[model samples]
Target: MPKLQNIIVLRTFAIIAVVLYHCYCPWLEAWNWYKCEYRSLYSFIFETVLVGRMPLFVCVSGYLFSHLYLDRGKYHEFGNFLQNKIKRLLVPCMLFTGLMCLILQLNYVENIVGYGFHLWFLKMLFFCFMTTWLCAKYIHQIKLDIIAICISIIMMFISMPKFLGIGQYFKYYYRRDSRDNGDDAR
Candidate 1:
């Protein structure tokens, strides 16, 4: 298979693994499958299936971007490349976000938060591509591609904590009224 095909397969598998974990883990809890306690096997499966997926995805993204960099030669075609990338990324993001927002507003869906969370990936990828494009365009002194990749990795690590924190915050706040104590004091 081609490299692009491999990348697509890897990314699709990662996304499927993550989504499956989210979907079925609650069923495992509901069934009391491990005596309501954590198991090493469960931990292993979780780590194998979900924990490493995003790293693989990011690595694939970096590999693809490297190929793009080689093809575009870092200097001449950067603007066109950046514009094409932004259009590809942004158009779908805005359409989906707007559509979901409208559906939630009209139907009063309680899972709007869950549906809307996918936009975070779109936004992050857009920023990553934009940063890579800028480095390719202006910062042509040194090997800026190396700098861009390193910066992307660092940003991903730093952003992971913030992402988890935001998820936790929303998880708590959305269910605040469902708490046993009914304490509104945050």
Candidate 2:
């Protein structure tokens, strides 16, 4: 398969896993499926499938980023590439956030704050792209592939409570109300 095709497959799988995990977690909790008498083997399937779903998505993202930005030729294409990326990332983010906010106002959803949560991923992606670009431009001679991976790992780790307190703050303040329930809460 072509590289682009591979990326697409990976991206699709990651997205599906995330959606399934999110959807399943609620069902699992709402029905107390885990505690069901004579729990079926499907319970094991659900537990295994949804476990670490977000990390799989993150790994796929990292893989795609490596494929895109690690090469010298791609670095030369940075201007158009970055512009396209910003448009692709930011436009949908803005549109979705606006639509969700409107839905909340119309009482289609309970929390406007929660609907705005999807923007967090886009916002973080924007910042990551910008930071990577800056590092590539000004910090030439530094091996950016290693740097990118390191930075990505660091960012991911910092967003965890075990390391930096920043992650905890982000979880509390920036997380959406829809995710406020402990099961789906990031």
Candidate 3:
């Protein structure tokens, strides 16, 4: 599939936003929220990125997927594609996160398994592909392209709030988020 220029531009900005957040976000640590450096500015930037960054990546993914498989009617080849993703994305995700768990010996094994440590995005991508393939394969009544779009929309509706919260949640931590942090944090 040919790359979309707008997607490439969005991806470039998203990468820059992630780098900036990690390097300079005011909430350097999670202990207290209101006492951070750039309370308003960093939170605003971070929230804006949170709202659209990953969704942009997923939208580009859907575009490429439509071009490669759905547009080309390569449904028969989906098995190979899924296997490739398992090898390329899921296998590496498990291996690396498992290694980290082994080395760190953290009690939060669920975290490693559920979220894949620092590889969460890759794991999520793998799941996204799997979900798309499954929906396409089983729900043969609907056209693959339409089904894919519908499913993606549903996913966005369900997932957008969580990602948004991950960005803006810190801003409310001192008041609301902290109340939830009562026992588990210690």
Candidate 4:
């Protein structure tokens, strides 16, 4: 398939939103390096972007993943796909998390879960790809997508275990709610 200009634009927008949300939000002091002085304006921008920024990123990712899997046929082989994702996603997350721990003088073992502090999106994407691949390869039915989505909705209401990186899903929802309630628990 030809390059998608619209997806590229959406990605650029998402990236800018993420940068603005992280770099300007004064309330999220744990994540922002330098908080902007205009708290009300930045808070409005932060709230607006928080709703759609990551979902836009994930939508673009799903589209690109579909393009590669169906058009390029690059991900048909399970082992190759796994290796590619590990290289593209997992390796960088591990490296960055380690570097963060080192730079912050944090204990590596205790801060292992802190990998998700900034890098959770990659880990979540890794799991999403694995699940998508399994469904496409084995189930091989259109209705499976519906089923998976329904299950995911149900899963969202329940608490995900705080292990194997699945907890990030719950954390995302929890953090959104907590932020709305003026509780910055991090």
Candidate 5:
């Protein structure tokens, strides 16, 4: 398969934006909250990037997911897909989160559910993949694009509790954005 240069570039920019957002997040206020030294222009900058930083990343990811897995609007090789996602996303998330918790002397149990460092994105991505798998498997009546849109709209209202890394869903509804045009190359 040919490499997607534009996606590579967009993903690079999204990663940089996410890194900068996190670097300055300590100074921004969240929905529930965060400890800010004092509100400053960082808050404005943080909020500005916050709106689209992860969404940009998700858009690229969705594009890639479609390109890789959804051939002719059908997902194939379920077992292989699940295993690859586990190996590529879940395992790394666990190891890095665990390592960071140990090194930082933080509680593993407290941090593992998508809160240890920036590794939460990995866990959230895993959940997004799992959600796609589920939708592709069971929701055969409706079109995936329509389901994605519905899920996105539903997610905007409900704040699911954090458990088994699911709070990461409500924390950021990237799963709701699985139909981005990242696969325009196809």
Candidate 6:
């Protein structure tokens, strides 16, 4: 198959944007005369590119998966598909997740459920794809996108993410609190 240069380029830029948003901005601090705050221009950056990139990546991923697998009638090779996902996504996720936990341990970051480590994105991707695959294979009437979206909405309701708001500013896009460790006593 011929490579789609636009998606490849967009994916690269999106990845860079995500990484840059996660890391500190030295130039912004220098401009502020050395007050390294997570606000002003930094907040603008977070609100824009950082907020957009992940969802964009996921959408592109879904599109590519459909184009390659569904278009080619490769769905019958379920064993090969599972093996590929395990090798490509799961193995690296497992390896890096352990390292991330170790780093967090060294830094004394406390949380229950291992806090999913930094590679939680990988785990999320794997679970999402596999869950969709199982749903499609077993329940053959519904559209996959609808199924995925409905499941996500249901999970959100079940999880009650509003009650778990991670950010203090309430106006932020990310309301799910990341620091909660199951201790209401704290």
Please provide, for model 4 over 114-175, each residue's C-alpha lDDT reduced to its tens digit, 9 standing for 90 to 100. 44446667777787788778877788577876776677677656756545466654444222
Top TM-score model: 4
Candidate 1 matches the true fold with a TM-score of: 0.54
Instruction: State the lDDT of candidate 3 residue by residue for 36-124, as single tens digits.
Output: 55466655666654545545555666566656666677645677888888898778866787786777685345644454455555665
Weakest 10 consecutive residues of candidate 3 by summed lDDT: 167-176
Badly placed stretches (over 4 Å) of model 2 are 4-9, 28-48, 75-79, 106-115, 140-186
User: What global local distance difference test value does model 3 have?
Assistant: 0.53
Q: How should the candidates be ordered by TM-score, best one leading?
A: 4, 5, 6, 3, 2, 1
Candidate 4, poorest ten consecutive residues by summed lDDT: 177-186
Clashing pairs in 1: none
Instruction: Give the C-alpha lDDT of model 6.
Output: 0.52
lDDT per residue for candidate 2 within 89-184, as digits (tens), equals 766766776686676454322322233344445545555456556766667655766665665555543434312223323433233222334433
Candidate 1 per-residue lDDT, tens place, 1-186, comes to 235788788879877875665444533342222234545665467655465554455556656786667664542476686677668765675677667567646331332323233444454555556655576567874677566456545544332222322432232212121222211110
Better-scoring candidate (TM-score), 3 or 5: 5
Q: Deviation in angstroms for 54 in model 3?
A: 1.8
Candidate 5 residue-wise lDDT, 31-74, digit = tens: 12346674678767765555577768877886788676665554
Error of 2 at 66 (Å): 2.5
lDDT of 6 by residue, 16-64 (tens): 8767755544433422223455457775676554656655666567566
Ranking by lDDT: 5, 4, 3, 6, 2, 1
What candidate 4 gets wrong by more than 4 Å, as runs, is 26-38, 169-186
lDDT of each: 0.50, 0.51, 0.53, 0.66, 0.67, 0.52
TM-score of each: 0.54, 0.56, 0.59, 0.81, 0.74, 0.65
